[model samples]
Target: MKTFKSASAFKPQRQTVVTIGTFDGVHLGHRKIINRLNQVAKTKDLDSVLLTFFPHPRMVLQQNQDLKLINTIDERIRFLSDTGLNYLVIEPFTIEFSRLKAEDYIKQYLVDQLNVAVVIVGYDHRFGRNRTANIEDLKAFAKTYHFEVEEISKQDIDDVAVSSTKIRKAITEGQIDLANTYLSKPFVLTGKVVKGRQLGKSLGYPTANLYIEENYKIIPKEGVYVVCAEIDSKPYFGMMNIGHNPTIAKDNRKSVETYFFDFEGNLYGKTLEIQLLKRIRDERKFDSLVALKAAMQKDKAFSINYIKTLQ
Candidate 1:
């Protein structure tokens, strides 16, 4: 698949069946649109493309910066690439770019640049200047431009619409299971393993510390989790604790410490992708090191037992 950072760079000669959205998590609802595009492209023998924005339109348009996101940029790109689309256009969302009128944008970017033959839109998606574009507006633009417009509805679970914001809320409130249900996968964190205090090593449960990325992808509030740790390209059973280390004298830095079960290797500077499986226990400040070690041991046992049930 080809990638273009802006509409001007798009040079596809073949007719394109396109879908536009942030597609942040590419959750179930997004997949419905993708399926629609796939069907349209296959029937029409046109190239299917996805257009999305960086810095999230909200981040560029709002005063308050939202920190938490379900997926990083790389994760989103990788998944979209794997979806068999012909192109993934990632354009920057700047003030000037955001100010384009609906017709101007549809003409300049979609028809003139992308050469779109068909546009697949989500049922409730809004675009264009002042967010005024609706499904009817899109259809009118398609009719005027001699292109096809397909509007796909949101896929719901238990009668509630699945959305990125709702998923974020679930993760924030520690409703990980609900978030996972919406995401169709576990809400995960990816980071680099860094050198740490070696406190877990002292307790015979060595842990790899994580250096978080700047995106501030949401971390579950201080707790132990039955997590799947991916390191050196293999997923392993493990447990992770995220919080200020309350066992020792308190400090200001919050940390993520994960211990790989029945595995030994050099983790320093390696990347770890942890799939948070289930919350085992809330973080607590133990009175002594022995108490902390005992609690960790129990957590490990609980995680192993839980994972075995899944297997």
Candidate 2:
């Protein structure tokens, strides 16, 4: 798929069939829309384009610093890449762009810039400054611009909305299986491996500490989880603990550490993408190092059994 950093950078070689949204998680419902888009583009002999925005609208409009997203921008792009889209345009959302009038936005983006032959949007979609334009307004504009406007049914839009909400809820609650069911894939965490206190090493369960830079990325409930990763093209299964090492440390800083089964290698500077498969148990403060180590051993055994079932 071809990716354009911004709408202005996209020079359409032919008229396109387009869909616009944040497409945050690109969940099953979003995929349904993309499928219809590809079908329309194929039937009409036009290219398909997905126009999405970065720095989500709420982040800019409401200054919602506390808002957490299911997937980071790069992760969203990675998921969308598998949908067989012809083009992707990641437009930067800003206060100035948000001020454009409905008609001006349609003329500037859909007509002049994208040369859209057909525009697909949800039935409840709104546009322009303060979102005053509705699907009816879009159809009226389409008549003036000589293009087609398709509205996704209310049911499909509802499913998309519900799934996004459920996915976030599941992740925050440590319901890994439920979240994966809604997403149709495992919830993933991508970051670099950094040095830790090596407490795990002393306990015979050496771990790789993960450091994620995106503060807005949603983290699962503090607990132990079953996770999988692909390192050097080899698949590895492990158990991850996301919490403070209360049994060993006095500081309150939270950490994510993963201990792979039967694996040993230098991962100090390596970046890893780990997929959460299942939740094991909640993190607790043990009475002693011996008790903590025993609990970890049980977690490892449970993780191995879970992995076997997948095989």
Candidate 3:
């Protein structure tokens, strides 16, 4: 798929069938919409385009700094690309952009910029200043612009809403398996491996500490989880702990650390995308370093057994 960083950068070569949304997770429900978009594009012999916004609307409009998202902007782009879309446009959301009247937005973005032949949106979708317009308004605009407007049914929209809510709840509660089931893929954490205190090394399990730069990225609940990652084009299974190292440090800062089984290499400064497979247990403060080490050993044994089952 070809990606344009902004709507202005996308000079469409042909009339396009478009769908617009944040498409946060690009989970099953989002995929359903994407599938329909692709089908309609194929049937009409038009280019498939997905127009999404970055810095989410709520984040910009309400200054919602605390709103966590399922996927970082980069991750969302990657996921959208896998859906067989012909074009992907990431529009930067700003107050100025939000102020465009409904008709102006449709004319500039959908008609002039994208040359849209059809627009696929949810039944409850709204646009214009203060989001005053709805699906009916879009159909009215389509008549003026000489294009088609398709509204996804209320049932589909509800399923998408429920899936999004449940997925977020599952991740926040450490229900990785359930979240994965809903997402149709493992929950992923992408970050750079940073230097840590080397406490895990002392315990015979040196770990690569992860540092995610996107503070808005949602983190799974505090626990040790079975995870897998591809390093240097090779797959490796591991266990990850997401919690404060209470036994070693009193600072109480949460950390994401992973120890890859049967793997040896320098990972500092390397970016890794770890996929959480299952939650093993909650994180806890042990009485002593000896107790922590013993607990880690058992965790390793259980992880290896779990990995074997997968094999």
Candidate 4:
């Protein structure tokens, strides 16, 4: 999919169907919205464009914003790129840009700049200065732009609404089963495998260390997890620890170290993707290296058993 950093940079395609949002997680709810966009674009022969945001509007609009994104920019890009979108436009949210009125946004950005033929919006999606443009208001403005607005179905799972906020809350609360359903896949964390202190190697359980680039990406609480790590496009079962290595080291920095079962290679500088299956145990410091190694052995055993159950 083609990417544009801003609408100004996006040259107007002949036919375009645009859906606007931050698309933080691109979760099930977001997928439902995007599905309508794809259908609209396909039926009308319009190019599908995803107009998303960076730093989310809330971060700039609200005071003391505590933004915990479900998907980082990289993750969002990778997710949307696979949906057969023609373009994904990422607009940087700023104070000046936030003040644009609803009519002005539609007139200038969508109609004039993007040359949007049809716009598919979610049921609750609001835009423009102070988020004053509701679906009703947008419909009226759509006539002026000579474009159609579609309100996609609001998705629900088990009678509960599916949303990025709800999914994030579920993950935070260790309700990953529910989060997985909303995500439509296992929660993934992908990064480059970097070198660690060789602490795990010394314990006779060498691990591949991964560096997380986006701080906003949600990580499960500190614990041992049954993980599936992919390296060189090959999947391997692994036991992963997401926490500060307080067992044999003095440091308290959060780290993600995974020991691939019966796998060995030079992983340094290699990119890896990991899917967290389940949490086995919470993180805790051990009194001695011997104690830590024993606990890790137990963790590995639990991970294997867990994988067995999965199979």
* Ranking of predictions according to TM-score: 3, 2, 1, 4
Candidate 2 scores a C-alpha RMSD against the true structure in Å of: 1.0
Q: Provide the RMSD of all predictions against the true structure, rounded to 1 decimal.
A: 2.4, 1.0, 0.8, 2.6
TM-score of 1: 0.91
Looking at candidate 4, the ten consecutive residues that score lowest on lDDT are 153-162
Q: Tell me the tens digit of each residue's lDDT in model 1 across 1-311.
A: 77888878889879999988777677777776687788889999999989888777777788346566678877788667767788888888899988999999899999998899998876776778998988889899988999988766555322224477788887777777787787787878888989888877878988889887846477776788888865667779898888888777346578999988978888888776788888888889998888898898799889889998989
User: Model 4, which residues run further than 4 Å from truth?
Assistant: 62-65, 153-162, 308-311
Clashing pairs in 1: none
The residue ranges of model 2 lying beyond 4 angstroms of the native Cα positions read: none
User: Which pairs of residues clash in candidate 3, taking residues 3 or more apart in a chain or in different chains?
Assistant: none
Report the candidate with higher TM-score, 2 versus 3.
3
- lDDT string for model 2 (214-274, tens) is 8889999999999999998999999999999888876888999999987788999899999
The regions of model 1 sitting more than 4 angstroms off are 154-161
The Cα local distance difference test for each model comes to: 0.81, 0.93, 0.93, 0.81
Clashing pairs in 2: none
Regions more than 4 Å wrong, model 3: none
lDDT of 4 at 229: 75
The TM-score values for the models, in the order shown, are: 0.91, 0.98, 0.98, 0.89
